[model samples]
Target: MWGVFSNFIACEIGFWIVIILGLFTRYVLKKNKLGLFFLALTPVIDLILLIITGVDLYRGATATTAHAIAAVYIGVSIVFGKSMIKWADERFRYYVTKEGPKPIKLYGIEYSKHYLKRWGKHVFSYLIGAGILAGVILLINDSSRTEALLRVLQIWTLALGIDLVISVSYFNWPRKKDD
Candidate 1:
């Protein structure tokens, strides 16, 4: 059983690596503007292969828990993707509009904190999204299943695409205005 157990451990490590890299890239360096782009693109890349080539990303051949974990990850990231967008907008002051930075408010309370200061939302969204994505994978495998999975995946793609465009624009904002 060492084979199975070792594989599971490896799977968890890989998942965290991607997440840790994202956290480091976005949190430590504060390059979330760029990290958001990557964050949005990774799944799109994997999704395309699943739809066209019928090959799984995390699963080379056997559908493992690793694949399921990755799916939850995709869903969560996209769902709370707006938070990352807001974080980049306020923290980096990228794509600054004529309006000034508004305080982050939750439930009518002025939180007055960084968007990422609320890691709970990000983690929650990531987990939920991953579950939905795992469901999509099961649907995709069903020979009798329709194209519904593709449609759901497309919705996320479109949403992420919009977020990506907005994020890229922020990067172009002048430093003078950011100060």
Candidate 2:
């Protein structure tokens, strides 16, 4: 049990280490392509981890709940990792180096419209992500495959709902009108 858990933990650590290293290299060290290159390779690490898990299962080892969660985690992270890291870097840089969150505009759309569009993209991205993870989960022969896939869908749905609420609330707020 500890062995399986430790391996998954190591994978998680490796996952974050790659992201952080890429982020630091790209943003902090000013190596934009290098950073993006590192971030872009995150899915490779995920694939490797998945392969490791699959090999273990092939060797007659029992799959645990931890393995299922790890699959979902890797799937979601691979799909959203680069964009999430980019978004965080922007906000972090803006807050620390400039004012608050940077305002984004597309095709003359201002704050709320911009955020709505962004959130819409996020929703679509997460849906695609969920589909990818679901397909992968379906391939696994664990007893919890259905539950794990359902959990992925549930989490993304909840996230989209929260984002919708925040975007709409911010758009409808009177104080920030015409800004």
Candidate 3:
């Protein structure tokens, strides 16, 4: 369990490290090809996490919260990773290299729409993660061993519901633009 948690943390840290390095190489050093190579490594990081979690489960370890979260993390990464990289790229280009326009700060209807789109992504991520959790539970076929994963699924479902409410509320009350 701890191993999963530790590796999850390491994977997260590594993801950011690779992103920063990619941005720096791309914008600061103007090494576009090398930077793209670094950026492309993000999926490999997700694969590593998935493999570790799968291996742990195969070793007869009881499913844990960490294992469940690793699934969620991978799912979220798959859904959001490209956008995150693009987000970083925009900021890096504008702030570091002065090679692009300032990233737009969405407000009003735009902000609400952006929020809703993000919420939709969250919904997709939850579904993917829940599916993985469910698959694991069925594969193990042991209630006692898979109880933690079921709990995670229940809690994540609740969280996603709450997020939906908040996301909808944004459309009702759009954000004000800065003066």
TM-scores for all candidates: the values are 0.33, 0.57, 0.96
Query: Per-residue CA lDDT of candidate 2, range 63-150, in tens?
Result: 5555555665665675567667777667656764464568443332366677787687776667655665566556665645346446
* TM-score for predicted model 2 compared with the true structure: 0.57
What tens-digit string does per-residue lDDT give for candidate 3 at 4-88? Answer: 9999999999999999999999888889999999999999999999999999999999999999999999889999999999999
Per-residue CA lDDT of model 1 for 1-179, tens digit only, reads 24333444454454445544554577557787765654555445335323422344323334444434345445564565455445644543323332346644342112222223344454465446545664656655752342434444555556555654544444354123222
lDDT of each: 0.46, 0.66, 0.93
Clashes of each: 7, 0, 0
**What is the lDDT, from 0 to 100, of the residue 66 in candidate 3?**
95
What residue pairs clash in candidate 3, if any at all?
none
Candidate 2 lDDT trough over 10 residues, lowest sum:
103-112
